[model samples]
Target chain A: MKTLLNKDQLNITLQRLAHQLVENHLSFKDTAIIGIQPRGIYLSDRIAHMVRNITGQKRIDYGRLDITFYRDDVQSRDIQVPSDTDIAFSIENKSVILIDDVLHTGRTIRSAMDALIDYGRPKNVELLVLVDRRFSRELPIQPDYVGHTVDTILTQKVKVYWKEKDGKDEVVLIDKV
Target chain B: MPLSVKHLLGIKELTVQDIEQIFQTADEFKQVLQRPIKKVPTLRDTTVANIFFENSTRTRLSFELAEKRLGADVVNFSASGSSVSKGETLIDTVNNILAMKVDMVVMRHSASGAPWFLANHIDASIVNAGDGINEHPTQALLDSFSIRERLGSLKGKRIAIIGDIMHSRVALSNIYCLAKLGAEVTVSGPPTLIPKHIESLGVRVEYNVKKALEWCDVANVLRIQLERQHKPLFSTLREYALFYGINKQMLDGLKKKIIIMHPGPINRGVEINSDVADSGQSIILNQVENGVAIRMAVIYLLSGKKDAQLSI
Candidate 1:
């Protein structure tokens, strides 16, 4: 099995992603990072931690969003968990960075963005994905930030296992050979 | 392949197995409470929209907390703040939200069966918080949960639900849930308010509270909102309270073990006496706490199953 983004490479990718966030985001103040729940949440937390360490800012709020209930795929999949929007701090007028682990067909990001707008309008919503796999997006959507891009067959699957979840930090491309 | 119930529209939409599955799942999720962290990552990437077309701070907040604790995102839309107040039809507003791709919808509308309409139109799972006074299935589930917790079993138990039967969705859902679980159900209310053919659902019906009170292990008092007294259903509030309210004396009429229950924001001295409301046997707060647990089960079960298939 060929490993993509081994532990060290994953660390570098996260650090680069963190630096990219710092460079792209104009101000640390009034900026909030909300991770799409499950994998995105951990990614966002890491991003937030990296941003804080790099910029030495302490006021930015990091939140987790579970977009289960607000899904078009509700008919196809059983929502294992109810959606949770745990924003301890208010999101009104704040600039939000919507973070996710992967960008596939762009449906989940669209849903996450939809979920974010309901909390109260943010000054801006920038989409950030760890991996950008070029697939046929059903909607006209694109990520504002990306860590890496990959081209794969439609039948192939990308499995992202983080140390916090699968006891390792790695991304695996599983092909239907 | 778990049973998915994203939005609960009404009890009418649920099969007996569907109802049983929810109760069972609620039983499992109840364990989370015993842990230090009362949260689950089941809905780790999902978001729930709480669309309330009615004024209900309690149900809205309960659903919100339930979603948050289960690790799902919650988006709230109230009639006052949302576009509905600006002459937007319920369909238009829901479609707009659906465009954003919400996973499930827990709706409470002033009009009866509005959530059903939304379920038909949208792809989100629908949980009917309250549809006018037609049905509050979760309230019924919580009420049943409280009863099951107190009695340990429901078979052959005499459970009497009193007050505003005609306009009480709580009474309607409770009747179905309790009867399904083998409770000897009796509904007592003014005949004017008690709808026709209600007794056909296999529950005994009575107009006199005293007669109903004498034969029950649990006397579940339904709230008597003044708004429900619409068009002079009753001549005087005092007369109604005196005649029907569950008070200290009424407690004596029943066996000492008969528990008192109310789905509150209580009418206080109106539907139930303050002493009874605050009494040792009052399961009102228990109902509130259990409401969340039952709702978590509902969200978990409802959201976990796919729409096109009935079996999970």
Candidate 2:
């Protein structure tokens, strides 16, 4: 079955995620929000804003991380390229939530986790993804908090877009076959 | 809260993944070049401003090419006729052009960390074309790209960055990138010009250039800043050449399969002899060409299309 999170639903999901994060981990003192570059950064920002409102003030620092280089499968492909990875702030010891739009084969998140560790070790590294399309596990990694979960076949693609990051808001699924 | 920049200050703020994406995207651009048209509409309607506070021919021209080829309107700015010469502050000058609502600003400055300063105040997206002697990120990207193209992989490769480590922004940036990408980087230069804390960045420092040249797969010769002689770093041009220049004889002692590189506008016989600069293994021109595509990747990413489905 195909499931999609419309704008309203996605907003609600984000609100709940923020509340859960606050309830599960009390106090925003050592909490830092890091969005995976591209989409995760927007979610991280949204979550940070929510956290600030809940605490009645700004209580968390945030950063954006790009994990394109840390991937293990780069050179095996036909292209061997590198790009700019911008993190406006430092990623010192703090509770970091590595945000990404979707969690699929888990390779991107895996690489992002590795890349984050290189910057510095955070006290707690949590994974928060918008969509979790269940499939066979590549690495033994799972999301700490998932907005929605759907079972899917291997020959499909899960896409997520946000107005702040992708110029629109919606989630779509496509048949790769 | 998150902020947007109209310019890229430096790669110091960039993580390995962002850089890797640039390389991956540039690698895609390289494939595009193989075709007959060799152009894309990815940056169509975007206006790119090349605001150079310092003089640069290759970097400026390459950025222009990258912008135009991506179908963006390109504007070239220099300090020669601008208000900068009249003692206008950088903020005032940047604020003036930003008022025009340009899409992006690609800048090169002489003062270290000047780009970061601009990024802090501006709302527009910024690409640090070159910032002082602090970072030449695109240069490092192109250099790394060229090395990967020739040597297959950057894993465990030994690279020696020779000359003026303390004064060479290329050396500083390269050490961070090369080391991050898994290259055992060694920086060799004169004792006075080599900073004491370079090893902190995971690079070994050496004072003897000849010895360093013999031990690596790649030898990056930094341009001897002719302007530094007056600052008491070195006595004379001839003295500088005698000690650190990459002459043809020095090339023979190093591994025959080694690659030679420079960030360009070479001083000919000073940092590198013309023969070595023009040698078969010299990837200087390739670096210049790769620089355009690599910069295109940087501009695309900093354009804030990170979440968009960017298809080549």
Residue lDDT tens for model 1, A42-62: 788889999998988877788
Top candidate, metric lDDT: 1
Predicted structure with the largest DockQ when compared to the true one = 1
Q: Work out the TM-score per prediction.
A: 0.64, 0.63
lDDT of 1: 0.79
Model 2: per-residue lDDT, tens digit, B115-209?
A: 77887777677777777668887788888988988998888999999887777778877887887788999988788788888788888887888
Model 2 regions lying over 4 Å from their true place: A2-177, B1-7, B228-230, B305-312
The positional error of residue B247 in candidate 2, measured at the CA in angstroms, is 1.7
Tens digits of per-residue lDDT, candidate 2, A104-162, equal 88888877877677666778889888888887568788999999887777888888877
Candidate 1 wrong stretches, greater than 4 Å? A1-177, B4-7, B305-307
Q: Which candidate is the best by TM-score?
A: 1
DockQ of each: 0.11, 0.05
